[model samples]
Target: MSVVDPGSTRGRIVAAGIELLGTEGARALTHRRVDERAGLPQGSTSNHFRSRAALLGGVIDGLVAGELREAEAVHPATAEELVEQLAALVELLTGPMRVTTAARHVLFLEAAHDPALRDRLSRDRRAYVASVVAVLEQLDAADPPAAAEALMALCEGIILHRVARHDETDPRPAIAVAVRGALSAPGDG
Candidate 1:
């Protein structure tokens, strides 16, 4: 079970933090702001998080937990299914999940300067990669791990472009190509 339940105070604070980060950037993520955003009493956020690093850590944990939950729902039985799933993921990230995606990008920049944050994010990323690798293995990819990495990179790029650059171009073609390439024989490509 996840430590941060969506209905709990801690989860509310974390969700507020993500919203703040997504809408107003990292500078606006203060305990007072989080408390206000969460519609809690003053000091509530500080009471739970204790420090800026702890608050950020809570946000990261919350994001990872939610992402893992979504990933757990994906189980592609074939290469084409993988492509469709990945394409839909891109659409979801760039659409309804846009705010969360923006918050993630903010954390990514912050992680560059914080080794602890970077480590935490890296650990979560490895978990996601492992899940993708499992799907690739099921589809009989030539090199599941490498292919998973490639697909992850490609999806990251697509998400970044769509979110940051506001590029509305379709991602299905690229996702299909990458999925097909990953499933191809090692020497056939």
Candidate 2:
């Protein structure tokens, strides 16, 4: 991950938003909370983001940027490689990146009443799904798009479960099974 500039007021506010989302969920996502978490003067967060939707947009941007930065290069042609990929991803989804996973879910729930958040998520969702499709194609799946959707859904399920439980141990084995099942015999699962 890139180093966040602490001196950047906007970055600090966004980081605070992520922290709040992770630790306190959507209810604590107000600008006042972000200002307190960021150690900024009252209303400073509003000065930067203007509104809750805009603040949520910053959090989405932060998460999406991190995702792009940490994305692995996929070149899987065998079950082993695909399983390994899934294993690493499961580690991230269930381990050190749990905060990000949680924050994303918070944003997802908040998106139901926030059009801007919904739009932002929709844009990122398309790119993320497309990335999965490309990887499935590289794996030479018979139906790359279908397999991608299944894998994406399976991945989301894993993230949601891990975030809900806050489990420490790696859940890679279970994730591997699901991914292999999804990628097996193209459209089979």
Candidate 3:
């Protein structure tokens, strides 16, 4: 849960790693490349992260910390407000935070083949879902955990479509429908 100081050398290295992954893909995520991207002296990244696995772990940590910070800024009082916030979040992810989002997607693909990375992602994902479940409970959802999972899946799908397909469609309407559905009881449909 500790935040990495962006001004610190470690932070710079992690940021550089994200940028490299997003722009140049996984193959370019070498220590030398990260050092060059961060404008640090050669071997600086290696000094901080002894291996590529360690470096990837650091990047995942940095990404989760930053995304959690952003998510914390959004406080929704009701289901409707949550819909708006979620839509805004989608825009933010695919717009201003595009590179970071892309970097996350890259890590997600990498995690599919790496057990340690997948475990890290799953842990973070559970923490994030728990926070959403708390919000849903406060909003009077019949099944807060399930509702939160659905909402998260909806947002992730929208973000993936927008980011991977270059789709410019407005995501609000779909978000509204999903949010309302999640908040509704089984027989209320």
Candidate 2, 79-185: lDDT as tens digits: 67777776677677567877877898888887898777788788888877788777777766677777777777776777787679765556567657766666678
Off by over 4 Å in 2: 1-7, 72-77, 167-170, 181-189
lDDT of 1 at 96: 90
- Write the residue-wise lDDT of candidate 1 on 1-189 in tens digits: 246887899999999999999889999999999999999999999999999999998988888887777776679887778888888888987899898889999999998998998898998899999999998888898899999999999999999999999999999899999998999997887
| 34-103: candidate 3 lDDT, tens digit per residue | 9999999999999999999999989988888888777766689987789888888889989988888999
Model 2: residue 126 alpha-carbon error in angstroms = 1.0
Model 3: lowest-lDDT 10 consecutive positions: 66-75
Per-candidate TM equals: 0.97, 0.83, 0.97
Q: Give the poorly placed runs of model 3, Cα more than 4 Å off.
A: none
Provide backbone clash counts, one per model. 0, 0, 0
Model 1 misses residue 68 by how many Å?
A: 1.5
Preferred candidate (TM-score higher): 1 or 2: 1
lDDT of each: 0.90, 0.76, 0.89
Q: Summing lDDT over every window of 10 consecutive residues in candidate 2, give the lowest-scoring window.
A: 66-75
